[model samples]
Target: MSPIPVELAVDAASAVAANGSPRKTFFGHPRGLSTLFMTEMWERFSFYGMRALLVLYLVAPHDKGGLGLNAATGAAIYSVYNAMVYLLALPGGWISDRLWGARKTVLVGGVIIMTGHFLLAVPASVSFFVGLGFIAVGSGLLKANISTMVGHLYPDKNDPRRDGGFTIFYMGINLGAFAAPLVIGTVGQSSLGYHFGFALAGVGMALGLTNYVLGSRNLSAKSSVVSSPMSRAERTSMLRKGLFWLALAVAFFGAVALAGHLTVGWVTWTLTVVGLIIPVIVFARIRRDKDLSTDERGKLTGYIWFFVAAAIFWMIYDQSGSTLSLFAQNNTSSKLFGFNFPSTWFQSLNPLYIMALAPVMAWLWVALHRRDKNPSTAVKFGIGLALIGLSFGVMMLAMAAASGGVLVTPLWLALVYLVQTVGELTLSPVGLSVTTKLAPKKYASQMMGIWFLAVTAGDCVAAVLQQVMGDAFLSTTSFAIQGAAALLAGVAMVLYRRKVRALMGDVH
Candidate 1:
């Protein structure tokens, strides 16, 4: 894809007067896209920085400067927290489209996240939970809307750079994610390292927020162009409704979090209830939407299937945050040439691969297009799931090599990451673009919210996977179970690829 030209930047502002799409150029890509890219890069740095420390810190001995939570508790908390973060994207997407506009919503989210990090910097137990709350809410707002802004950058789906644009945007995500664990995780896990890491994450977020503020003019013009005027009463009504729902969501999640300790029955019931509500609501809504044609309805049904398949993939995949990280620390020998690499450092591998491979994927698509051999996005997604499944099996094989109960070599985990990165390249960015493409135009942002919901559900299910393993670490049993599950799910996705493609119709 060609970079945006200098002349386009001048023309963009000029065209604004005529109420048309603006043109811009800086890095072969539009300045607006770059602005979003930089903002996301720093935000992810802060987020992943905290994440890299979370599991390790919880399991580390208090004497070693950690929280000292048991593995199950830590995994559960991590899963719920991450789930809520993505779940919040639903409201985040709604507000961006209906009320605050994407720019303002992102700014608000950044501030909330920064505040959460600052609270985390405080060492008290009280502050820990408070900080987590802020982070979840803030992430919910920022995560989904930022991607939506990228779609707004291109007026048409046919633009060749659309895929490249999403790839560039995804690179920003990996850039921050790649750096966080190496930098922030190092500080937080050390003696006095935890506070330092938390502080650093906060600083990163502050920088991101600052960037967003400064770049607002360059980034938000698209939102400004489409924004409709809201009356005072409508604004008030929206605020009232939003606050009510926010309060309710918090209470509901809070109850569930607390209920986990009450009884197994309560937790099980809550999960069952939450799971049933979605399908019920979706079915009723579909029955009511008279405006949809048969094809559109079929498309929606395909999305639901994708969500199910994606949830299964993510449930097995998200173990990197907890189960996988623990394996690296306790079960894998990191020594290479007499130097032991930190377990947290392993977290960086996937992002590093992403950084390295994104350009290749972009180029491959271009090359394939030139040859008229381009595969459908559906094919790519299926391939992605299969690769992820294969990655876990790679880890299982590594465990098999440790049949004597000795720590496995670190190279095994390295290979696992390599495979996972290849899988991510196939699915993650493509899925984001697919949401934009397959969605009905009327509910573009809302459909994105639904997509995020699938991701959040996967994260929540990951907790179950972690709990089922229960301190087993890299045991052969645990490895086989998780690996077989991931592998089988991936295979199923591949087999169902034809049906998924037919539902997607002509989406390229």
Candidate 2:
């Protein structure tokens, strides 16, 4: 899950790719698209590169150049870090609109991200946590704005080519994701050590920054100008609000420390509470909007169901970097063809599977659509949930196969990733497509923030689930529990799909 939700900035349509000097279209798109595509490709390379190693490095023994933390602690950190990245997108968008424009924000964010990775190259606990913080904040600033910049490439919001262009750009993201684990995992999990692997991630960000500079000429100047410059009164209020929150955070941490509850696990759960609350507040505010009609209210009700379903789906799917990565290391064998590979290489499977499977699924759906027989959105989500749940059930079988204490074959995990990819194909695109249409027009821009919050919420609950599993985290019971939750949700969706569709109004 290299960031969910396809809601990029739609308002930047006024900022088309700078057309001049008799330019050519890229794959029938604006020439500037190539620049953005590559920049994003390298940026994603940086992101997924570090993520693949995060939990593994944490739990690895210090003698092996690792932190030696337990699985619960490591997974907790990983989940909250991921949750925070998506959580920050709300403010990231606000910063883009009010302070620096997207272009500057993205550039600064890239530099901060690069600094974070470089800090990660240093092998110290303090550096490790600080590096994670920098990456989260920097990604917050960069990820949202960079994705939004894609919308700037198309001159018209409804341009026939816009969807195709977004599809292609998305492929660039997957390309980087697919390649990262193989490269970073090999180095980090190998004799050269984890720090070197992290350094390589820094180099990847440097390459992304280099690409941005090379492509700067073709970028949107419209992003260089703030759309809604904040008034002085608003600025004063924002400053006061920021100070109040900052002081509150300091006091909260101080109280936690005085209460003898200041620890990684405790902090992680606290952040989880914040992550869970954000979407609730956002949804409540949106529901209270006076502009929404009765029809819009109906769609909003349906969207809530889909949101819950999406959150559950992501809770399982996005565990690849945390629990699944550990399973690959501690439970699954790394041997293949007389050579042992890095367990982290398993991280590459989802994106690679996505690249290979997406088109096949697309063709299948479009073919069915031609006959007007494609599954409804609710059914698609149901099918996706079942597939992912079945994939975890397969892992239960793998655990049974490894009952003799012999590590299971990588193929078992591969089978799981492949099945999950199929499920992803079934649900993910439909989720994005439906989200844009489900929201009221007044809140269209805010929809991206809310949509991504689904991932944030999922990651938060994942932290909760993983922490509560105790020693069973790696056992068949854990698999059964996770698989059953999804299966029950899928069955419910199937049983009530018609009602779900009806609540969606005309959004089919």
Candidate 3:
């Protein structure tokens, strides 16, 4: 019932009622969570729906209405697009902190996202890339901010309900992801065509937008806009500068594209360089701030490991959409129980696994805390890394089984996803919680964006790896190397867990 921590900087009115009585509830949490939960569910529907189709569409033959790109080219495009979706979160956080509030930014993002999905339905070459660009930008705006808004619903930092609440929120994301492939994949791979599937994704986004608008009254009004908004002139200046840089980038790329020399390879390379440099610059700037105390600086340094670990985790996990998707199409058997399913449905396993595991894991976190037995964040991360690494080992075994151009059983891939999902449960939500805990007060709002930069880093490196190695990216040696890196990272985190704990001070 007290004010939220200053480091979070969320207004207290967000969770406190004017009347101060019993409030409406969704499954024993705040009613507002339902709004956020449903909104995110539909947004993910749009995102994963399109995601399930992107690589397949690119690799499909020209006669089948695809772009007819090679596996390498398709993977490159997928990786780059994924990179941009996360990379822009840095600026997206800036925009929300200074101009739009979390609520407004999410709304604007939804509109843009809907537009992008519809554009993707056009079935034109120009529209496809353009649509992806729009969705990336919109998603960047919406992603971190919406998560921040969810924090607003929980005013008490020590409330035991916090982790469980987030688990429910996370489930909303999984719900959308679980359903998208079945619905969109079936439609796209059917007689109706891919563009129709894209359109349906847009329809899902539109539904989400409608739900959000209608439920706005349930959200906190005080937190609907930026707390300290920029002045008109400052806002104008910032916009102008952003536009100038953007125009320069567009012009440069447009000229190259017109000359037919700007390929997916070029875009991915640029993203790789930018992604690698961003974390360095941001980390240095934050670390050097004079306002920080000795303990704060120590914590920031510890965060570097977390950042690197997250990058490694995502690099392998996200390949489900690209490298693994291609494998499903080319190498995995689709027939199960005498019924053939689309390869795209394999992507759904992640969310399905998450759905099944989230509740038990969520309850375990709270119970462990209550019993004073919860593992330190670093240890949890160690478990996560180990699991993801093991998933790769499973992949290597599957590769061996399919050595002579044989189609491996779907069970092999399912096992990989299952192991990886458990790893994700250990690390992903814990990462979000720890990022908010360790972040500096002055830059409270922007911390989520900094967190997302880890994803950008992973995706960029992944794209670059695929680009440089080309077809060799599929080799068992590649999986072995990546898996070993993760396993080693896990061991290092555990061996040095005491140091990280010291760096965290009282937070963990």
Tens digits of lDDT, candidate 3, 1-508? 0011111122334345678865567776778889989999999999999999998898888889788887877887888789888888787777787888889999999999999999999978789888999999999989858877877777777765565567677778888999999999889888888889999999999999999999888776644868678999998998899899999999998999999989766766877798889888999999899999897888888888899999999888889999888888888999998999999999899988877776678678888999999999999999999998999888888888878899999999999999999899899878877898888787776777887888888988888888888878887887888888889999999999999888888887
Determine the C-alpha RMSD for candidate 3 after optimal superposition of all C-alphas.
4.5
> Candidate 1's error at 185, in angstroms?
1.6
User: Residue 309 of candidate 2: its Cα lDDT?
Assistant: 88
Runs of candidate 1 with Cα error greater than 4 angstroms are 1-25, 28-34, 150-168, 224-288, 365-378, 402-405, 472-474
TM-score per candidate, chains pooled:
0.84, 0.93, 0.90
Cα RMSD to native, each candidate? 4.9, 3.5, 4.5
User: After best superposition, candidate 1 residue 72: deviation in angstroms?
Assistant: 2.1
The deviation in Å at residue 306 for candidate 3 is 0.9
- In model 2, residue pairs whose N, Cα or C atoms come closer than 3 Å (at least 3 residues apart or on different chains), thus clashing, are none
Error of 3 at 65 (Å): 1.8
Per-residue accuracy of model 1 over 1-508 as CA lDDT, tens digit each: 0111111112234234345755555455556778888899999999999988887777777777667877766776677677778778877876776678877788899999999999988877568778988999999989868877887777766665565666677678888998999899877766666867988999999998888788777764676542654778988997899899999978976886777754433453354345435634754586468887777777777776667766766666677877778878777887887996678888898888766666677778778989999776666767777777788777778777766767888888889888877777677667767777877665664776777676667876666655655666446676666667766766766778788878887775
The whole-model lDDT of each prediction reads 0.74, 0.85, 0.85
Total backbone collisions for each predicted model: 7, 0, 0
The C-alpha local distance difference test score for the whole of candidate 3 amounts to: 0.85
